[model samples]
Target: MKMNIKSLYAICTAALLAGCTDLDVNIESQYTQYPINDIAVEAKNADVYFHLRDVFGRRYMEAMSLSSDEYTAVSYGGGWYDSGCYSHPSLHDFRTEDASIDWMPTVISGITKANTVIRDLGGEEAAPADIAPARAMRAFFTFIIMDCWGDVPILDYLPVTNDEVVRAPRAEVARWIESELLEIIPQLTDEVSDNTYGKPTKWMAEALLAKLYINWAVYTASSVEQYEAATAENEKLNDCIRICDDIIASGKFNLGSMPYAEKFGPDNGSQVEDFIYAMPYDTYTATGMQYGRARTWKNAGDVEKSYYGMKLSNSAGGYITMNPEFSRLFCLEGDIRNNSVIGDTVHVYDPNTYQPTSEIALDENGKPIVLTQTVSLEIPDDVQLGVGDNTKGYSQGYRSVKFFVIDDDYKNGRNQSNDLPIFRYADILLTKAEAIVRGGTATNGETAMSLFNQIREYAQAPLLATTPSLQDLLDERGREFFDENWRRNDMIRFGTFENEYGFHKKDFPTARFEKTCRIFPLHRDVLNTYPHWTQNPGY
Candidate 1:
């Protein structure tokens, strides 16, 4: 596997990363041979992980947070009015290239790297154990692409021509991913150590399968226009339970292992035991993780030093705000998640020791800074967003503290060491409980109520007294995973993505049930590059 290149296929990699090859691409050039297989399986796999980091950044967050009911952002009178693209998700009135669409190429970049590793290793048959992780990661990237943009292309090898780049139907893509994951699961590592830290393991792969099964109906449905979330049923609900049971029985994860807030701080990494899979963003080495820009204020380094033990280098105050309806979920007495969402007024903490001080945070003219949970996303025409540096939100909505920062983060400026949790052990218990509630009898002796209460009881919140229903499970998911990028998926599954929450309504009523809005249409560039492809219905 020595290095050599100078082929159109090499150039096609760049094209594919930008999207599929253009129509004018010279198909015959793909015939030129190159000995570019110098990339090791591990190096190609590392590239896959790094490419995924770019995806979880800006555009993806706007789509996931801004679209869903969990959080929203507006002009705030000064900024965030990105020509109305920022509010398109909430309003359901979108133009091409909205935040939700660009991740296709970014995700494709990761998938292409994973595919290259598979191809260079002489295909999956030659080194099943040595290269199985790449196959697993490839499936993970495909899952994101499919979840976001319904019917999409599936590339197993480098295409020699544009004709090889046709889009696969959504159902076909899901089935192919399922078969690929099933074949590679045994080859995946079973350990949960540093060797497999950010990479997918047997448990994480199973978790992915369980997720696919639970959403089988939605993915395979002819159309979501008439879909009902309350009475939704999945034929693979039984399969989902079985997969979740295997992970739960392994005894590797525990909710009681750490305090609720500690699960997302700088100390939360692979060894934490609560996370099944996470994106390991670090302070000194890893980069591209800036949660402060989404939640913290601009002058936090000078104002609220009592926060995470370092002076934050940057912040985008009011760039995002919590929705009132979703904010009510944190009202349970003694729930740790409530402490993270700052509302009303509280004392300012000391910076040096990160301790509580007698001094309270006040706005410009000596007034207490208070956070509000207003029902409307609109601000009165005469009101202002930021008056002075000291204000927390005298006229603002609720703020968040998820994906918290710490002292080590000071070294990397705005970037943080907080490992982003994708799947957690609590999700396993909840998924199995949800599957059972949806008419799949648990093969194990565990009842739906027993498994469902594990998450709530451990979080120190009240436990459910009766059997959980679909709506109850939906509400519980909203509470458990607010800002972790799970809201859009849950909202779609529950048939609520089309409804207006906080910011969608400005002057008049805007909430209605629309099917096409369930999944975003293919990007404009994608549609134009491949003329044969049709836009999603009703787009």
Candidate 2:
């Protein structure tokens, strides 16, 4: 809940900062070289919580989304190709060298930082209650590591080339994550206030468990076939549901505090009551992501601004567009989500004055911007024309205005003023609904249908008459949480990730439906450092 507690971050000793990185080859020796016995938890956690934002940089989101059905980043002949990287993503033909999914170092750095906090606080076994957040944090980032790479070294200690750092089996990692989360839940504070705004708390830890259990089969599977064999009837489903029920029963987050549309915006802060954990990306203090800028519209002549007047900082041309086919379901009669899903018109706003009149964004000829729902891996020359030429390829995908980008930060630059949701109450509703429908026992008179209807009722979408099929819940998750980084995770869980969607063309088959495609190969750069590590299956 530490939504922007950068104010509390104090300068730490250089030795502490020196040991917080995973890639700093000398980090371990340096930490052992100078140990701190009196480091403050708040100061160390500031470094720990701040790095959480780095987990999702522009490239990571692009790869994960493109690999899923989220959206496409095609080559405008020469536009987004980036030395053939874009080509691989759409075809699902990723390489060990692709920059996409190349942020492992950043993730490891986060874990290393958390470990430093735990070590300084007293070591993991005997760390005091105050370091519960750090323990939970280690579990949190470790989950991300396990999710991306099947088997990874658990850097719980500073290994000076620990030369012995070995990969833990995926199942063991899962069990460790589950056990670690349980151990710290009771130790974490339940108070909800500015003090816990962006930090880990009891509910946040539970939410992490809910996420881990929801995708348990995928994370624990040794091979693609094993993951594919998993069903909604996963043994962990009940635990996922139980944890979700506990979080819900606490009465901490509810729909009454904020409407569906109001939860994602620059002002969705501590008062909204739906965020279980959201990253606070302050322009000055914490990490500010390029998400808003990457999603901002940059269609025509020098026109580069979001619906809320947040200027597009990336001059690189193409912004994220929703798949037209995927976007169609947002048209449900009473669903207000459609309004923010993708606007038919680009409501032009003055970049300076930041006020909206009736004007529209225009191309070079001063014509109103034109957009198409169609997309392809490589736009034909005739259709695409050229990059930034206002042709089909230049503006093919629909721009999503779901997260209203506003100039609410210090320079109106891209900042956490528009905080991103890591987990929301709405996700919990769908989580339980899916679990019950998947054959987990429903409790407290709550049927999968009733729980499913809760999300629909909140969105003003028509309620489903009965329990939804797995596909319905999956599609509904797409419609409700699009562009929020859950699409790829959802698709993998539902067994549809290998299917072609967005730009992942069906014919460019390098590894379609092959179980190995489920988990990505560790990038060559990573292996080059630790040559002993094994790549994921079939890479």
Candidate 3:
């Protein structure tokens, strides 16, 4: 069932209350009565869905984006920078006690909730439909945990003892994810209906499996020994190609033809080709998407209030603006994705007519305010690139509005109804192309060049005359998926994440690029809870 945010909230609140001291019940009885109750399996499933929403929400998006080259923390922007988490992330200086460490508990909560559903459904009275999605979500949560923190405790259910919380091998966790996704794909619903709109489906499983196999070598390798062994076999890339081919042959999705802005609009529910999985949001009932306020300037607030009737202050606390170099990837002449970046001439509207006026803002000195938008693909000259240093003014850098501010979404302030696309067919096509470029062969008349050309054609940008190199594909992904929360993974896979890029501050005393910083340190709280838990290297 498609559980809206409000309903899920109420369900989760009631579940928490049932296990509280006010109930006057024993701890064991409360656990049995609330979490594992046979009648509450559906409600538990709904809870799991809500947890997944939390997992992929705006906070997680901002965190991942800041860690990559796609964005640089604004020295004085308002959104995530105000929390002080952007400093370390922007400089590639993650600390064991950094504020981003909070994400671990949120991820663990989602995993625990999904595990509850699976345990409850394991009974004789279990429903296959419920078991399928629950298991898939569990794997999804597990994948995220391992992806971020490297080795993590793979909890079957909640841990009652410290030993139960010990970290599992990263390789084992990857294999578990692969096995779970493969086992659940056939059981997941094949059709896209309201019942499965924001939920896991067969296609999502296939896409996720493809993702795992493509990143197999990265996930399984920590030391030189493991790294050499992992790459010696092309089986992982071959498996990725096999899954991508299956998804393509299924004919369930295609590349979306809508304008880039409209693809993320409130009414984008019907657009099919691009979405493999999305987290549904509703301003009134289910809401957690907040990119409009985070990326737009405060000067544009009047426009937002006038057009959409929502009041959002300027992102003066550190808008997640793109590194000057990353912005250059777009063919500003024709690439539709460039629409998200506000440039030299912003549309000024007449108060009465609410139509564009032939006027621009002027500074106190009578000079016209220039919103210079540039993505510096070259390394920055100065190296002190942290908050409040080497920072640009509000409109200096190219700010992203990829998740467009629709009228209804603005009317509701930070809340939005646009479903966030987690995986889409466009990504699948790119995955297939990358797999083929890495040695796997194309299937069914689909060549890597053809897929690349299709995306370029849709954007009205120049097409390639020759096959693309791995670096070319990496740049293409930067332009196509900018601010879509995939840059970090893509950069890591391309082996460019640790390379010095635009506006990167040298905060680390040692070399600028530290290999251990790729995977974040385990949260201190988790280590304190489990004495046997070990931290990731270079913490």
Candidate 4:
């Protein structure tokens, strides 16, 4: 069951605390009365938790890149493709129709439910591991709000009356997220189920908390005690570093030297590198999105097509493509990272036979060549250049091959495996590097440089002998974690929230990429539901 945002909200708000009600009432009065004791098994309803997870996942996939790329003016939620397609677009308008899914309510709902579970399942009556899971789940959801939409009304549980639903500011929300994670960190169990590999571990909490602190500038506006805040946040990052180090030190997980494709392949879902948090998609027929059934040809599967015989694209092809600038950043010769993440030089689509199952062909020596097997969309043929350089046939140019699946099983389209890498070890290392850079330190400090160089070495990309500048760390982050949703926050931390990119710099008529556009507006309908809640500044 897909856990919709509304369901999370309903579950969180509906949480009935252990002592809040009396049990001696008449049985006939209630048609479906789940005694508080009955709620103990509710944690097993991973279905509900999974839905909430999906809700958070959707927000990350869609809304996480407000500060990184260019701004193209496509239809639904125009900001992403417009701002995202290029190296750096001047404006990433948040108020447009194409903004990320309204993630506020869904996250709030999850946090509420998790807290309620923690509150109610604590007595001697609670199950062996229920409380830990509840706390972990709560921490997971709260981190999303703290990281994405700043300043939310942090409700510990569902409000008894409508008046209690008023929202809180970003700082207060961050504190609340921190408090919840700290409260539950010690309570969670070390051992987790195999199916729950991506589920929150104790280390995951620390990492997420560290991430929240890493973006302290955007969260706190760097107006007060910026150094202290950065320091404090970095401390949390260090704590996270320690946590990952400890996990690594133990025999539980290890870095796999497997090729990048094999590392992310479905068979390795249970592998140690993948042992970090990831969403597992199974092959069960009715089992909720098993096998990457992408909705477009860009995604390797039997999704739909465009009416004009062009490949039907989703959301202006949130299709992950490499930015030309990012591509240039990489060393073309002998960089294994290039081969691991980047792929087939070109991805050309045939309009005449653009059927769901029609095999994509390539042009070799000016002759169309067809491969024996089904092909995944890797680097696309589209290459949109600057104003002066030829602009013909380059509208949909320069695609990313990082998330494109090329394993053999996806011949006809879509596979039942391939867990999406939400948070990975590479991210952990990158975050540590960024935190060290932004944590009230010098531009060329050893602490930050060491972390940054490790990533460079891992990628087999050249590393700098001298320490890196602060901007260097941020730029490196862009290259290391592109399209993974860390760009907006990293840009904001580096003080580039308002820069322009792609065609948006000269194209957008009304919007300018300003710092004021950081947080999303409280959805208009949500404001109608709760009038007392104040919208974020400048939204």
Candidate 5:
């Protein structure tokens, strides 16, 4: 179905109205204008494409990062702090509301859009090329909700009434995600062409399956079944290995020879290592590539604005700095990943020349214009915060420059053009290595040690002579995928999320670390609307 601006507006208006009613009626009305017979194929495809973009925005990424031990909330001093830094109950105990609540509706809306595409395109009879990406997207969105909230309502088909809005078991949702990916892999395109660049492809389906299988126990296990859960978890780990083997053998992608920073550069859309999918962003057409703002230091803003012309709003609160432990994951000696961190020094530019200068610039009070403090892996007790403050010092934390910043001509007001990678070829190698160490077989041409060294080679770090333990693998993932939004999930899977890391003790001295913190509470407003909904355990 081809959608014009008028039809798009109509569908959006209907979705808003239906959102007030039953989930079924909501989805049904959202697709009323673009019925199967009336809509063009191009319109249906465009709808799915737009929703995929909407689903992969910065808010989702920042929320996941803040919830993990990947960052330490640096204070701006005088009691000023980023609300997002300390506002979530999961991140800091003093906050009353859950941050994940704000995300629920947006994610649910994405799923609804995916469903509309599948339904209007003829359901089971829809063309494989057209429906496969939509199915994969729906599965991906579902997996995220389940990963964050445990049990969520699964609206597979359009509903007739609101009575169907009941939470599905997490394990059941996991199984459905597994089944959906397995069923659609063959139908997805194997090649990476212009049409498939940001869309879900065959490799993405396999990657999603590998992720699901590897974290199966965390996703499905119950408190009552400890021993049984471990056994099932190991089996799922093996399944993860098999799926990863298929992805590695597909010959569609390989670990690129480019430096780590270059892989995330503005032109990264052309990088080969980006195996599964990327959320394509452009300054003009597709925007919201704001990871740079969330991670960049406030003092550096003037330099960025002056030199690069990139506007640094710092509006998402303040800079997201590495939790002392996460920063130490990088080998400062030769690891390229370590180069992403900015500390101590600020670049000085000549005002007239607008070029980088050797002399450090000074403020009116005679202090350095960009005051950078030595960032310690151990956060100071005095800066521990349960609320925002104005006194947080500027230089107390190390900033991440992982994402690419375009040339100085790039305007601050424009969104970045760097493509956000969802999955990479290096991740596949690490997944295989970890699976092997966990007792899964390696059938994809490389031993676990060899695969491990492949990444180390690119990182310019020393190779391992012996096989790595699970802890070593976890450390490697932290070093490699840091700031990419996988840390929280990795910490949970490794059983480290409940530990007192970073400044958690200072901020919430008496709080207990519990398993219920694994899945966040459903937003309070969502519960108020649907009285039948039950909150997660510890909310």
Candidate 6:
């Protein structure tokens, strides 16, 4: 079924409030709008256009988080691992066709909408503003494909028929994105408008180009000449000294003045300082899906005396948690990100009203545990948690705080106003530092760690040695961008895609995956449906 604005909005609102319409909204279409002169017809098209834009952001975040870091693992106590979905048969192995399904349709659907908008706005009589959004949407979708699948079926020319579709190599896709951004940069407004703050400005295009170059080795193995070619394509990266430098000089974005926890912690409704581009969320609009809450176990009660929350008379459960290996990487002290993103404290919830009670402890195993003896919604203490031994089923696992649900308002398994950071300033600085390292420049004598220190300073963490090596940069990226969805690519870039990490990497099931696994398989559904389509090699 075609996704219309009303329908997409309805789903977001429904998910936020379980199922209710207490909050109502009428969003104007970013494309396909009725002209004031032709209000009725324009309104119809606008409605469809706006829904298309919504899907673009929604799908973009979900795909990136799942495919990249922005997540904790569940290996020990039935937790999710960064590579669990990447290598397991029943989980998410990108080596085969099945792993690409969930995100493929959403992207293709969004592309369809973008194509429609571009077509309608380009017709004989249409406002230029109507097409501005279309151009932006196109760039956004193409960027996703470029980053994720690498060599993708570029639909820039729009559909002639399914038979006409052909796959473009990774290098070509990258070029397309670079070209699209350059073409549209002039059309986009540089102003930091409210809803559009996280939207792509010309600077975002520049930053993205830097990111593309920084990871160029991972996408395609061209020699030094190819590397230089990528750098040449982005005059902006040079103009800004680095894309991050450009973003800072732009003076539009900043690190949050608040502490790290406030910036990425439970009480996340407040404006985040580092957001360059993000997906807007709003509780009142009833349109936010708190992935953070979804990843977190419902730990509101326990055994003592009804602990801290009202016991729902009944319950159904699902399993997801943090991996022990991934969690251990956080320093016990000094790194502020540990406290902000990973809270070791256990908050007991009152059974009468689900609020936290102060009591944190660790089990004999050294894992943190919460005491919820009194309430129905209880997250088990570590000693009692399920570790998939058939005795226990995986409880007491660490919950995700990346997008925390702080209050009953936009809180508790749902928060709308918490915008998803699509791009951040720190990302820029690190990308530039990496590019400089690879480009053979040590003029500053400041190595990758020096650049990493700049990002660390923003996170309020201490700096490493000023002239650390390339491996240090890779490790820092892992820690800093963990679960943020850059792992598969980073692994490839570091030449670790086939290698393992810690214990999990030892007995990985589908171990044939190599650097080639960096790119996802073309969707089987698409391949099967289109007769002339060809699959990627090694798939």
Q: Residue 495, candidate 1: how far off, in angstroms? A: 2.6
Question: Arrange candidates by TM-score, highest first: which order?
Answer: 2, 1, 3, 5, 6, 4
RMSD value for candidate 5: 5.5
Which whole-number lDDT from 0 to 100 does residue 59 have in model 6? 37
Q: What lDDT does candidate 6 reach at residue 142?
A: 68
Task: Write down the lDDT of every candidate, Cα atoms only.
Answer: 0.67, 0.69, 0.65, 0.46, 0.64, 0.48
Please, what are the lDDT tens digits per residue for candidate 6 over residues 1-539? 11232344444334321111111111222244433333332332333323323443333334444343233223334443333442232122453344323465556555665565455455335554455545555666666766666666676544533235666776777667667766766666677654344344666666666666666554454421133222333223343344455566787766657665455443243256576655544545435445543454443222222222233221112133444445555663577666423334555443222234564433324445542111111233221122442212334434444454434433333443444555676777676676665553433354556667777887666777666566766767766766455655565565544444321233444334343445566676766655576665456
Looking at model 5, residue 537 earns an lDDT score of 71
TM-score of predicted model 3? 0.84
The list of candidate 1 runs beyond 4 A from truth reads 1-39, 298-310, 349-359, 363-366, 375-395, 407-413, 505-513
**Residue-wise C-alpha lDDT for candidate 1, range 1-539, written one tens digit per residue:** 00111122233334332222222234354333223332334444565655666467556777777778887564454455565556666556555676555567667767766665565556635568767787888888888888877887887665554454777888898898899889989988889766566777898899899889888888887665645776666889898988998888888777756767767776677667788988877554566677656666434554444344444555544567777878888887777667667666744543333333466665434556567677333444312122222343324567776666554575566677677888888888888888898888877779888887888888788888999887778788887877788788888887777666775554434432466777776778776666788887768
Candidate 2, backbone clash total: 11
**Top TM-score hit:** 2
lDDT of 3 by residue, 201-318 (tens): 8988998999898888778875312443214444688789889988888887877666666677665663555788887776766667776666655345533342222334432233
Give the per-residue lDDT digits (tens) of candidate 2, residues 75-105: 4556656655645654566679888778777
Off-target runs (Cα >4 Å) in candidate 4 are 1-45, 56-59, 70-91, 96-99, 119-129, 192-195, 222-251, 266-268, 272-275, 283-322, 340-395, 406-416, 438-447
Give the C-alpha miss distance for residue 482 in model 5, angstroms. Answer: 1.0
In model 2, where is the ten-residue run with the lowest total lDDT? 379-388
lDDT of 1: 0.67
Tell me the lDDT of model 3 at 193.
56
lDDT of 4 by residue, 283-305 (tens): 33212321122112232222333
